[model samples]
Target: MGVATQLVVALAIMCAVLLAVAFFLLPSRSNKRKGLIQIVVLGDLGRSPRMQYHALSIAKYGGHVDMIGYLESDPLPELKAHPNVNIIALPNSPRVLQTGSKLVFIVTAPLKVMLQAWSLWSVLAYKTEASEWMLIQNPPSIPTLLLAIIVCYFRKTKLVIDWHNFGYSILALKLGRNHPLVRFSKVYEQLLGKFATAHFAVTDAMGKVLRSDFAISSPVLSLHDRPAPLFVPLLPSERIAFLTQHELTAAEANEIIDGNTKLIVSSTSWTPDEDFSVLLKALCEYSTSAITDSPQLPELLVIITGKGPLKQHYINEIEALDAKQELEMVTIKTAWLSFEHYASLLGVADLGVSLHTSSSGVDLPMKVVDMFGAGIPVVGYSNFKAWSELVQENVNGKGFTDAEEMAGVLKSLFDPANNQLDVLREGALKESKRRWDSEWKPIAGRLFELTT
Candidate 1:
């Protein structure tokens, strides 16, 4: 009785164990359904060219993106009916709370380091089953990022840190190299890299800096800014007419150009860092030379758009250069506009300018892409490697080192015999399509992978 009963009991137990294993391993019908990816964009919602590009990319790829940040006075209209996007507004108090929390880190630096490590361990314990979390670069609150890293660890979610600019570098440049905040930022960046699953650098140069400086082993992907695709067809004639009409009708434009204007446009949020004053100086110099030499010289019309904290400074600089008489400054207050309207304005401009100094680094500005899409020639400074590569010499545009060169480039672009305008227009359209087909489509594919 003992041997037979024992054998039967052992067989039954073995079968039960096998059944349990199968139940756990076998795929369920629910697992076959489409996957959902939820992305939290921690940044401002309005007047961000980069954010707009990312939102459009995610929307096109079927991923759900939620943006949490401070709201603007005039909210973006495009964000309203975006199918796969959600904009969450953070209260003012949270920002103050987050800022106050950082004082603990500053005052008790060594103790805070130990506390942060302990907090990371505790957070990682709770996040074993969540999806990946990506923290976009240039976070306004450093404390918030520290907390996000802890949450990412606990959730067992992959962490992606997108680096737009090296905050430490910016700080070192503005302040001294030995500034405490700059040094601390570098340390925090290294720590982030050590913990992050992946990294995205806005430029190849920035990626190089991260690898060389921080010794970060994580896979760094270059997520350079690519312009939004233009859905509207290219209408060259209408664009020309728009510019011609604006110059003729607008008293400011007329005063600047004195009818029969040679249109040169630039749209930027005139910041001290942008060096728009150089552009104004160049424009004024060109106007003065033209008036003295040729009585019938084409009226040089410069249209400047965008408004920022430095708007008054830029206006004063323009007035100082006597460019106010030859330039029309159009300040943009609203955060949103239809793509059609933006494209139409861009298309009308004969030439577009994007000039920035060494402090700006190799930025892939959204306006550059817009110029390409609108088939407008762009002239700008060439300190940026990315800009140099894209804006080929005598192809799309010319990148200058100084204001004199900038004016010379502009003068050349206006020459009727040069016929460079036609060539540039064709090249820009080709480049725009190339960007969409290559960079943007791949990004869309990546978003699809995350979502489904």
Candidate 2:
């Protein structure tokens, strides 16, 4: 507030910066590691499966990896145990960021970002083993992309951006497209996004947008998400036990054990991007319609897993449906599962449902890939053009436009007379043969100059 106070704050920052520089200049720390690849994520390292895959793939290919991010949850055990992988966690968010008032946010957002950027720089410049290449995840791209650009410029490291989705578009979801913040984020990303040494797009549609819209000169590749080796069919015993403990009542458990119920699984972050109400309405309709079907349709046991701000909102909606006894034919269970448990549950599911309506219409849901990896076909919302890239209608999976279509597809797939579910299951098993390592190798082999 006063000149002396401001000068003291500024002096302390200068001293900290000088000390950081001096510490890294020491002979032991000065030997910048050769052939080490840095993987940076602004989000939680454990929740970010794609970046974890990047680290694991590098380690698997005999390259050393330094993964930097917040360690909010445990990453894959394979990555933790890898001899070549070293995880460097950044400091968690500052306390001021947790405020509920808009006025407080307006005053504190910049301070929070400055704190975050300083922490990131500490890891990049001091904590990590300096490498020739740094791969960063986007969509939390505000200060992260700028920080990476600055650090890479100073250290002479090649910066790589893994574009999961447009950060501006995500911002626009809450603040409309015309919001100043959204516009600024768009300009910011476009201006700095071109500085990357390379770009990895999650879909080809995104690749086209980068090249044509962003006018990026660097190599842009479509590095689609594929299932890690961890996703596989759970053994029958484990599946039964899992359902019995968490999902089914005693009678329902007996029904499940007796093969009298169909296990349907869907994973959602429960955000506006994914309209979960569609899934619920579809289930209610399906339950009511199936009550009078020929051969008496197998009761549906639906499990939904994930956590988000809208979770309680939807939980209340689920409760309301239950009050009316509208969900009699279908029993819905919701849980926030660990990554391992999520994978296991998907593995044992009879069918998978995806309600992901991409905000940009170009980004694909990684959850669908996980489900397919578990050898279960998906019933995805088909409105987005990119859905075809992952979910092939009547083949490995089918696509639906609304509740009516989703209900109809469910009935046809699960009906004992047609055996449609078996056909899709076989197709999914075939699709599961395509794994992440095979997809990662060629691009990584080229990017890092490694022989695969």
Candidate 3:
């Protein structure tokens, strides 16, 4: 209790404080280590393009990246070829979760989370070397966020959440907002969200919401989606070869090759957020308009891409229409395409359609970005505020609310006489120049630079 003893205790406390500050501020300090970044997604690696782009950017700058996700589909060819990138495939979901009743899902949800938690914990805590940072996709955030928070804490890693959309908003689509599970998810997301070292929002609106509504104290960056280098417009000479060699059957390809049929493309997850009914009903309306109302409109070959739960339901509807053979002005085709093929299709297609009216009003869809990057004009569903950020009406793209409106947009854009299609394609080409690497580089360099 002497004065000398009190001074010694104070010095010990000061030393402890300095060590704690050094531990946390390492990313901002000049002595930053190499970015051993871990990028995670609960969904398929191929389906999640934004996170893949993140991994690609990290690796492009000489950082070592560990991308963890489901390998349901193939990712970009360059991602596989990158020597600095190591992709760790997560274990598959329980069979009951994939093919199950609503009641069964309610019963199995906890078990699914537990299994996922165990897998992630083992991989993050034991299997992988200590990392400097982690960038994880949010949406199926239940187990991802929880495991990330714990892993980052123990590993002394910085946790970053790329806010594409809220997990609760997606779940609320099936379970109402008032549902207890949905309510719990929102609370959990917000609580854990504040723990992130930083945040990357797909739109400026999303960043604002994170700071004001979610009360997130960390720095939030508006890092909008941009297409990777693979997505580019195919040359006029390449069209015939692409159609013949790739996804489209020869017969389907020949229809457009031999006729004045316009090829229109749309990519969807085939989920409730994207009501394929909107596109389907619009096609029927478009057929009527293209025939009787707008004869100037070209005949259409519509291709909808990507796999989802509702895909088969929409396919059945199309099959029924085909069996009836009542609609002659437009033909419908669907394919679950690889990124290479998907990019090529976008490049060659005359127009792109997006049915994504976001579950959270703040998100911008990456499919629209891909379309623009491929120099294809888009007709996006515009119920959400963020749609304006990417789809500028009459500029790079147009926006529609209902089937009738979408049909009208399609008819006008596809009409050969108007020259509107060329105008919009030119605008999209301008947007295409604003590619992902340039947008991602400055941020990636600063964040992942060795000895920051």
lDDT of each: 0.56, 0.82, 0.81
User: How many clashes in each structure?
Assistant: 6, 0, 1
The candidate 3 region of ten consecutive residues with least summed lDDT is: 24-33
- Give, for candidate 2, the lowest lDDT window spanning 10 residues: 22-31
- Model 3 scores a TM of 0.90
After superposition, which runs of candidate 2 have C-alpha atoms over 4 Å from their true positions? 1-31, 94-111, 234-253, 292-295
**Deviation (Å) of 26 in candidate 3:** 26
CA displacement after TM-score superposition, residue 124 of candidate 2 (Å): 1.4
Winner by TM-score: 3
Candidate 1, position 359, lDDT: 53
Better of 1 and 2 by lDDT: 2
Off by over 4 Å in 3: 1-33, 247-249, 252-259, 450-452
| Tens digit per residue, CA lDDT, model 2, 1-452 | 65533543565456447546644563223345678889999888888899999998888777899999999788888899999999988889966475545445444555666677778877886677668788999988877897788778777788899999999988677667876557878998999999999999999999999999899999999999999998876678987787677543344776766778988888887777888899989888888877765446788989888876688889999999999999988888888777888888887788999998887788899988898889998898989867877887788899988988988898888777778888899889888888998889998657887654
Write the candidate numbers in order of decreasing TM-score. Answer: 3, 2, 1
For TM-score, candidate 1 versus 2, the one ahead is 2
